[model samples]
Target: MKKEFLANLAEILEVKETDITPDMKLGEKVWDSLALLAVAAAFDSIYDKVIPVKTIGKCNTVQELLDLVEEDD
Candidate 1:
């Protein structure tokens, strides 16, 4: 699930998978509202977890977003 999430995220952000890190800050130009929306959709489809966009918005880093995606997936 984590791999898939990272791959999907990399695709959404138009970056290489190796470029994304758990500790990476989401201050890049690619990390915009649209990306977050796509991430929300990906999370629901990939992990069957419907995380709120508002809740997701609170994430300041990749790890924060990853935290929202529990290991149960």
Candidate 2:
């Protein structure tokens, strides 16, 4: 994932950048309900994408979450 994106997410989730990784699971200790909302808002604000909560629900890792927000190439 992009470093800037990772940093932005880490800040939103209130975790250190070092703590975030592709394998990191969402809804774990650091990613709670408020963090989930922040993720949604981040996508909307950064990418203008409206990510469905259902889609977020299915993501198991930080990579999955980034995939949800990243623009298609």
Candidate 2: Cα lDDT at 43: 83
lDDT of 1 by residue, 1-73 (tens): 6777677789978899998888888885378889889889988987789999998888888888888997464
In lDDT terms, how accurate is model 1?
A: 0.83
Clashing pairs in 2: none
Q: Write one digit per residue (lDDT tens) for candidate 2, span 1-73.
A: 4787789888998878898887887766476667778888888888788987667767889888887777573
In candidate 1, stretches whose alpha carbon ends up further than 4 angstroms from where it belongs are 71-73
* TM-score for each predicted model, relative to the true structure: 0.86, 0.82
Superposed Cα RMSD, model 2: 2.0
**lDDT of each candidate versus the true structure:** 0.83, 0.79
